[model samples]
Target: MTAMLEMRGVSKSFTGVQALRDVNFTVRAGEIHALVGENGAGKSTLMKVLSGVYPHGSYEGAIIFEGEERRFRDINDSEALGIIIIHQELALIPLLSIAENIFLSHPPARLGIIDRDAVYRQTRELLAQVGLREHPDTLITDLGVGKQQLVEIAKALSKRVRLLILDEPTASLNEADSAALLDRLLAFREQGIASILISHKLNEVARVADRITVLRDGRTVDSIDCGAQPVEEDRIIRSMVNRDLAHRFPERHARIGSPVLEVRNWSVYHPLHPERQVIKNVDFQVRRGEVVGIAGLMGAGRTEFAMSLFGRAWGRNITGRIALEGCEVELSSVPAAIDAGLAYVTEDRKQLGVILADDVRKNITLASLAQVAPRWVIDDVAELRAASDYRTRMRIRCSDVYQETGQLSGGNQQKVVLSKWLMTDPQVLILDEPTRGIDVGAKYEIYCIINELAEAGKGVVVISSEMPELLGICDRICVMNDGAFVGEFASGDATQEKIMRAIMHNKRTSNGARESDMPMEGVRP
Candidate 1:
């Protein structure tokens, strides 16, 4: 196969900090090339250089495509040559229809006017090619994450993309959706479309990648050809981190104790639909020094339950009894929830976890300003000391406390989020998809943090879509389906098969109906 794209000796630096160091990468025509690395390892940086996000003259690099040395001045220059990149965060406008988003920049025009008929016709064809069965008029907001991903691919096809760059495309998708997306990639491969996939999911990489490239500390370390021999996950990890991670998760010996957080008959109604109940009456408990995992597929209402528990931040007509260490607390608002020693780490870190525009110090101190502000005035010295303390404690790698949060890598940014919530000194913390897009090394660090929190006698509740993650770290796992717990398991007893079976059995028994139809008084998992 001919080389479709090549980036040779590429280096990018940000304010004296080198993000990429002479990295070399290549992708064959009609091949799926997987780029694997730890956060801050320069994978995304290298991709940016190729896609013109960094642009020419901004970075040291040589980009060769189809036997031609390309000097792309901007993303438009790259796109003009059939190179399209879909970022980790989907760039579609929520208010626009699918057809509009697909052709927002380069719509089919007739006599200097946008052609609505041609736009819809082309969008329908692209959607069909991507195996999406939706009308062109459907709003981007109305589509699910999986469908939105397909829309992104469809949009790429609109530009006649020959080389597709997808960054963490399936990080937020469930198993079925991810599989569907991968299948589309395989189909694209058959049609001679080359793709560069950047993902943290090793299993998925192994399944699809024709070649694998490993980058570490801003440099390319190794490139494995899957056609020559099989690639082991451990080998890739070792190359990426420069050390052996014998265990993906740190070992934990939980010391369970008395209940620290308890909820009885918790129910939440949809904010928009007054007649619909999003969360059924549920009983839940988290004990001191215990790590509890909530395992559920997408749309299982896990996030809804967590948000409603945290001062009714997400649902309407929220009725629940929350007791902290045997004392009933009134969590009527976010401030009250914080005052009651409850903290929630959201899944969408970029949006809800930390302020990207703010510096690391401000983000770390944002949640507990009162501690750094004595006499209702923020003391700079005290704030700096507190923020620096967490920066070291959380192992957050950044230029300094003054560095912008957005400038840090994904893993480091997540540490900042954890540091922010930890400053609140909460007794019980709920982490929703805590390590969603994080790499293996960073994931281990996050797991260790969760263990340390539990060891400190804090009740920790983790909600994750990855079953293996829950199994590897949690002491207990609860299977939730259709807004209610269907089964529970100890760490020793839980398996992916068993947990999934419980969810499937519940769905079968209920015939896809929610527990909301039942009376709230006697409902139990």
Candidate 2:
């Protein structure tokens, strides 16, 4: 089969840093090719080059598409050639309707007038092709992250995209939603659309990829033919890391102490719908020197529960009693929670966790500046010392502490966020989706850090969508379903099957009760 896209001896540099060196890659028509690498290993950089974000004369490379040499000057040039790249951070306008978002740049305009009906009709057809049940008239903000991803795919299809580039498409999706998205990708493949998938989820990559390309330290290590025969995950991992990964998860010593943080009859109402409750009467406790993990699918209210208990940052109608070190405390606001020795690391780091334009030292000392400076007068020396301490402790790779946090890799940026919370010296730390976009090596380091926190006698509460990560790191796992804690199991006792079964059981029970109480309307079965 002839190659759909090909690159040879691709080398790219930025301000004296060589991001890509002598890289070679090829993608066949109607094939799903996976790109795997560590953080800062030049995966995104190479994709940017291909998508014309780097332009023609900026990088030294030869790009051949459909046996024709092409030099794209910008994203529009690449898009004209049927090459569209969907970034990890979605580029959808929240207030716009689905139809408008789909046909944003190139609308269905007739005679210099926008045709709304035509746009909706075309959008509906595209949505149906992607197996999305939502209407084109719905607003983008009204849909979940997974459904919004489908809209993104539909937008790509609108451009008649021949080569689709997806970076961590399923990073925010739940298990079922992730599976559904993968199925859609496979369906696209059957229609002869090629894809370049970049993801940290090796299992998902192994399941869908027709070929796997491994990159490390700004160079293409190897490309393996996953469709040639039985593809082994070990073979791919070896190629990517250039070593045998004896164990994916690190070892942990189980030593749980007395309950350090407790929540009794916790409940929170939906922010948008004030009357509807999101987190129903939940109860749990985390002991000192113990890592407790909250596991659930998307919309399971794990994050809601944590945020409500920490500082009432998310929900509106919050009714919860939080006790720390045997003393009940009132956490009405963020300051109140911090005053009560509590800290939370938000999942959306780029938007919420850090000030991107700020330097590392400034962001590190943001949360606990009062502690460093006793009076209203600022103390530069104290702040610098505190930030420098955390920089070394967290192994944050940067030329200087004054460097901008935005310039760092995903792993290093995550470390900066962690450092910010650690400087607060809270007794109970809540980490929400701590290892979301980072690589495998960075994940291991984070796991080690969590263990160290537990060893230091601090209570840790982890909320993760990944089942294996929860099982590997937590001392105990609590399963949440539909705004409630349905089941609890020890790390030693919990299995992926049991957790999934509990969620399903709760869903069935809830549905049965709802059906018995409420009258059936226009609901489709």
- Give the candidate number with the greatest lDDT: 1
Residue-wise lDDT of candidate 2 within 254-349, one digit each (tens)? 678877787777788989899999998777788899999988888889888888887889898788567788777788989899888899999989
Question: After superposition on all CA atoms, what RMSD does each candidate show versus the true structure?
Answer: 3.7, 6.6
Worst 10 residues of 1 by lDDT: 516-525
> For residues 1-525, could you state the per-residue lDDT of candidate 1 as single tens digits?
779888889989988888898888989999999999999898888888888888899999799999999998889999999999999999999999999999999999999999999999999999999999899999999999999999999999999999999999999999999999999999999999999999999999999999999989998898999989998999999998889998989989889998888787799999999899888987788999999999989999999999999988998998877788877777899999999899999999999999999999999999899999999999999999999999999999987899999988899999999999999999999999999999999999999999999999999999999999999999989888999888888899899999999999884223454433433332232
Question: Alpha carbon lDDT of residue 21, candidate 2?
Answer: 99
List residue ranges in candidate 1 displaced over 4 A: 507-525
TM-score of 1: 0.96
Q: 414 in model 1: Cα distance from truth in Å?
A: 0.8
TM-score, every prediction: 0.96, 0.94
Please report, as a residue range, the 10-residue window in candidate 2 with the lowest summed lDDT: 515-524
